[model samples]
Target chain A: MSIHTLEVLVENEPGVLARVSGLFARRAYNIDTLVVGPTSNPEVSKMVIQVNLEGHSLEQVIAQLDKLISVISIEELVEGAKKPVKDTQPDYQN
Target chain B: MATTHVPTANGTVMNGATSLVKSLEAAHVDVMFGLPGGAILPAYDPIFDSTIRHILVRHEQGAGHAATGYAQVTGRAGVCIATSGPGATNLVTPLMDAGMDSVPLVAITGQVPSAAIGTDAFQEADIRGITMPFTKHNFLVTKADDIPRAIAEAFHIATSGRPGPVLVDIAKDALQTQTTFNWPAKIELAGYNPKIVPDNQSISDAAALIAQSKKPVFYVGGGVIKANAHKELAQLVELLGAPVVTTLMARGAFPDSHPLHLGMPGMHGTVAAVTALQKADLLITLGARFDDRVTGKLSTFAVNAKVIHADIDPAEINKNKFADVPVIGDLRETITALIPALKSALAKNSQDLAPWNASMQKLKSTYPLGYTLPDDGSLSPQAVIERIGKISGTETIFTAGVGQHQMWASQFISYEHPRTWLNSGGAGTMGYGVPAAMGAKVGAPDSTVWAIDGDGCFQMTNQELVTCALNNIPIKVAIINNESLGMVRQWQTLFYEGRYSNTSLESKRVPNFPMLAEAMGCVGLSCERPEDLDATIEKAMSINDQPVVVDFRVHRDAMVWPMVAAGTSNDEIMIARATAPDWDSQEL
Candidate 1:
């Protein structure tokens, strides 16, 4: 099993993060690295969620991510894209 | 000539009040319950016109508890707002309640202006520092620019991992600041990320043990309820064919009607559940931390069983009992993973429950939650609880404080649905019932709410009674008045050689609760004997204009049945001595 990094673009609003985090939380997704920052567009922000998965669990994560209404775009940043950056190391769990 | 850079006093670029609303809206705070005050006037001014519904609470504590109730019921962070000094201090009770119960809540307060912060200015208090230990995290935002981040941080700290309450303080000047506000809906907290899955090997090992064990039991906790994994828990338990013993918080996670459900297992647990745990070969604990009340003198707890503990919080994993297998992950994920693994393991082997099932049934008939309800006059706490339960029925929401009353309520009440019964389980805060009941009412405004409490426990925060009256929150307060600290007395009689010192409140100068209720502008009823109990409670519960408090003068020495005496194993619970009825069993 390896950790996968996912970049998610979402609408900027209150509870958007809670909904996303709660989705991962309720589904039992082990979030490792989550980075959210305002993009050039004021009404949208990019969230990078890193989670470890066994086998095909990453597919489930991607599918779940698409279900959130606030999520505009999601791309897996593991293996090929950005090739496993050390800075993406998992930080502390809140 | 005056170039002191005062930032234009009140009309500066940052209006701390508006910023708070924008930040709260950014945090997706749907509603906020609070009472307006002089110190928090700036914040209220904007809230009056904001999209976020602001409820005017009777007391600051009520606001806090309402948020707690909302959070507990909805599994989202409940939000409340209050002013400085007295208002902030009042929010403490509910904040502490939420913290103790592991409910996610966000409490925002308006502090005195920065210039008047520590001078005890008419409504000035250091709420941030005072609430530090009791909260998951707290922040005192001095700069107006930090208002959004502070609120965002509070919400993050409150709802993430090991959920609890968080407090944010905004100075009056900060609320009045006028600044460029772009509410960022999402946040990236650097120091906060809760683990949601266990190491694969630990999960494999736990699954293996469950497969090999002949007799196994699953101990569930509030974590299962909070994680919304009740169905998953049931699935796993069914897969393993194990009996479940729930902590106070975990009630309703496993249907009590299930053949394998053993009800609550702890200081006041059932004999069947406790005995099942004692005789098990392996204990698969999910979302439950080993609380002392559940595992008396840890050394003797489940001596025959090896523990496979799974919890979301890492600190709780090996804190109490050593685990043969420790799984740190969200309960839903852990259970989801265990189900498939256990199914695979069980496919290779088979076991029968005939022997284990027979033993549990024997314990149930031996020491059921039984008590004789007298037809005559002397009041029994059990009878009082039974009557209340009968009236509330299965659909009503019941909340209790920590005391003999709480135990009695847990015993007598039949909770059919999950989250219907709320209480301060682990923290054991005495004055929690009323506030919590009030909170539950706010959560389900149309549902019947009953706050059951003991005389000793009620007085701890009886002040909230006023909050109920002022808010017209019609919750029935059932006071099991033995006129003494019943739990302590029972402990003294059972363990400490019967040295009932300082247990009796007979001589202590306490206010007349009924009269106090009247003074607080609520209806009060007192029942000195069993004959008046039924009608009195019915009348009290019927009141719709204001809250009602009923003091039921119960038997002083009455103890909650099936109690596991301290330092003793759960198997050795003391049943409600079925022999004596105290002679006054029927009369006043």
Candidate 2:
């Protein structure tokens, strides 16, 4: 299994978030982390979803998500680029 | 802020409920199935003024299934309405069933007032949240002005692409408030554009594969019927001159009497059909999703075949199995394009597939569908279904609740046209027969609709018979009463060492179906003797003004033959239990 991040842009409408999350839930796909916020366009909302799944299952989940009527676009995030990093303490020895 | 309210051109200010009804009328929704309640009273108030005819169902579940039945018959989005809380929850089963089967339906429910939402007010429920997982899309209308657009979008989403149920939960206050209603000329759903035209390259590739293959099998599914591509599919099948196997949901998609038709393929499918699919080299799956039931032990199923999966839904293409060439678009359009492509590509080659055809024909004749009649005088379920098929002929729309009866109907009936058979294929929801039959009769008023139900399934949703009687829907219901959950009992008998656990229904305590039908204003008849079968069916067929119910008490131990037990490969199919033979080993 691999961890993949999908960035989805959807129409900013009521229940759009539910539609996205509900898609994952219905398929029984686990979501590691999900973050939603306003996009640059006021009419659209951006959702960053991280899921741990096999390649085939991830492809299916993405395809299913794309079929949603409210979903505008979807992009998978690369491993090293713009990853969310946790805060680290200063090393005393260094 | 000062604002002036402008009335519509007709000088009529419409409320949310009125606007919703008007939008349905604009969509040409002539019939609806629903039950009214407190929050949805406003919607019902305008029904009298609208041209839409509403059937008051006995229960919300019945209404939803009725809508699914209507959608399956008309190829349009069937509309249903319900009130808040329990009423909305009651629609969950049918919505999920519709979602699984890809039936087009639009369900509108009244929610608690906007101010009362989330307050746990009386009759308050988050219906949008509840139906989110199953519905294609759902809307929660907080404002009165959004009614028209929401209704239009719901209809569009429900009927387009991979069709399924869409829910619109309108707040009670929205229904009560007034607004200037203007029907939108076109829907503006930016993300919902379905690709109706197939990619030409993919079509040509599929056509080339079809033309070159020596042993090809066309695996069709409900999508063929859903897309109304029967004509195109039949043309392609005839062009390829290959055997065709229609899945359970696709029983009527292809004519059963066709020369190349190899009955259904699944757990209860014909041996020849299953054997052909398992051994075929090229599998051209048209709109079939390769469900687990159809693919027993998927790793070994069609291992020798290179699949050409053509489906309207792109998600279903590679969901279960890898597709060598995927044609993603509407089935009708894809098949229409592929037909000519195959004709041009296969014009020169006259590759004869005599040996394969001969082998299939041999298999078909060798182990034909058979069941033994009991010497005791009790009726066999298969015989009953076969007799019904013979009497009903090709024009009747036969529906079934899931069981041995459903398999028998699928095996025995000859469906000459599309949309003549409706059932819950994916969900296998019991109690679907009666309401679905009612909806089918309503959708095709001139056609004879039959609901062949098992006794176990009939008790689940038989209350819809009251709705049928009151609505003057003349549907025929034949209950195969085995006094047990026949399918489950058979499994238990085979796999569970003859231990029948809670499968037997206490028919003695339960009201007799014939008497119950009589109480519900339907003509009821009970047939027990095998000789009475033909006469009973003829008597039931004679009734045209009111609904009729015939209870046939079949033998409880009679099991469906040619069984391929779950998880077993198709090669392991058992015609029947082997018995000891008289020995003459000395001569051998």
lDDT score, candidate 2, position A34: 98
True contacts kept of each: 0.10, 0.55
Q: Write the per-residue lDDT of candidate 1 for residues B257-306, one digit (tens) a residue.
A: 78777778888888777777777888899888888898876888888889
> How far is B22's C-alpha from truth in model 2 (Å)?
1.0
Instruction: Give TM-score values for chain A, per-prediction.
Output: 0.80, 0.83
Q: Best by TM-score, which number?
A: 2
Report candidate 2's fraction of native contacts: 0.55
Residue-wise C-alpha lDDT for candidate 2, range B1-588, written one tens digit per residue: 111222242225888788778777877799999999999889998887888999999999999999988888888888889999999999999999999899999999999999999999999999989988778888999888888778878887888888999999999999999987866666767677777888888998888888788888999999999999999999998887889999999998999899788888878788778888988888999989999889887877888889999888878867888988988889999999999999988995545667777777667766677888877868898899999999988999888999989888888888889999999999989988988999888999999999999999999999999999999998999999989999999999988999999999965347698999999989999998899999999999999999999998988888876776778676566677542111222110
Which tens-of-lDDT digit does each residue in A14-77 have in candidate 2?
7888888878887899999999999789999999999999877876887788788888777778
Candidate 1 residue B485 C-alpha distance from true site, Å: 2.3
Off by over 4 Å in 2: A79-94, B1-12, B348-350, B578-588
